[model samples]
Target: MGGWFRENILDAGKLPTLLALASFVLTFLITRTVTRLIRAGRGPFRNITPGGMHIHHVVPGVVLMVVGGFGAVGSGRYGVAASVCAVVFGIGAGLVLDEFALIVHIHDVYWSEEGRQSVEVVILATALASLVLSGFSPLGVDTLSPDEREDRVTVVATLVVNFLLVLITLAKGKLRMALIGVLVPFVAVFGAVRLARPGSLWARRFYRGRHRARARAALRSYRHDRRWDRPRRRLQDLIGGAPDRAD
Candidate 1:
């Protein structure tokens, strides 16, 4: 185990990344728990306000991110300083992304339905970080032989092809597939060849006059949402608390 850690994590220069990802996940989870408790009036936590202005956690998050990011860049990626900067950056990222919805809407909607976007973004970030920790390299180059990796032409070609495939997958409205495809090219390829989502750019452009294809896409989307929406919502609510009911 120690040998594997050294070879795959430390030697590969992934220790800092792993540390940051772990810290991000931990900080986000802790933040969510505390916020939920505060919302329920069951904890000592209270909102921060100064000079009649409500101060959101994202303020400190941005500060920490800037300091840690510059520190990491300046100090290099080995030893204690790098590790500390990575952790700080991770904590800042967690805090910022936890309120992604608020940032997007520029409002205090922490408990509203729109706030669920924050949960979704956090989940996506966690999944991506986990993939990285699991040794999946972005752009799917990790599977190449050392010799192929060393060849500039081969590497560039592979990256370009994979990038186009990812773009196609995104156009098809398969965001999750596209994201995973960055680490696993085959997934992106599959999404590229599949039917586009009914409302996706790909469908609007290519399947516009194709009634049958549009019908199939719509039906598939409806069935998929029916099958997964509730379960997905339940999972999000379990992790981040339920959205506040409309008054």
Candidate 2:
């Protein structure tokens, strides 16, 4: 375990990234717990307001992100200062993304169904960070041998193929799969070959005259959603607290 850490983490210069991700997850979890307590009227935690304006946590999050981002860039990659800055930035990111839906909608919907977007974004971010930490390079370049990496034609071909796969995946309306597929090419390949979502660009373009394909795709999507949605929501609620009844 120690050897693996040294080789995969320290030697790979991923310590700062690991620290940042850890801090981000911890800060988000803690923040959610406190806010949930406040919502339930079971804790000393309270909302912050000033001058008749309810101040959201995103405000401080943005400040910390800026400061830490600049500080880390100035301090360079490997050192105590950089690690500290990374942690600060992570905390800021957590706070900011916690209210991502509110930022998008420009309204207070922290406990609404739309607010679930924040949870989804956070999960996506965490997954991406974890993949990076695990040594998965974006665009699957890390899979190349040293000679293949040095070969311009090989590199270009690999990049072009990966890019097309990513585009196809996106057109299929598999946003998360497309993002992750940049790091793990096989994921993108699977998405690219799969049936597109009912309302996706790929479906509109290719399934226009194929009623059976479209019907199958829609049915599959419905079944998948039915199988996963409830469990996913329960997990989200367990972590971030349930949405308010008013929503």
Query: Quick one: best lDDT, which candidate?
Result: 2
The residue-by-residue lDDT of candidate 1 on 5-24, one tens digit each, is 99988887788888899898
TM-score against native, each model: 0.94, 0.95
Pairs of colliding residues, candidate 1:
none
lDDT of 2: 0.92
- Runs in model 1 deviating more than 4 A are none
Candidate 1 — what's its lDDT? Answer: 0.91
Q: How much is the lDDT of residue 79 in candidate 1?
A: 85
Worst 10 residues of 2 by lDDT: 238-247
Candidate 1: 10-residue stretch with minimal lDDT: 43-52
lDDT of 2 by residue, 121-231 (tens): 899999999999888888999999999989999999999999999999999999989999998999999999999999999999999999999999999999989999999
**Candidate 2 off by > 4 Å:** none
Q: Measured by TM-score, how close is model 1 to the native structure?
A: 0.94
Local lDDT at 6 for model 1: 94
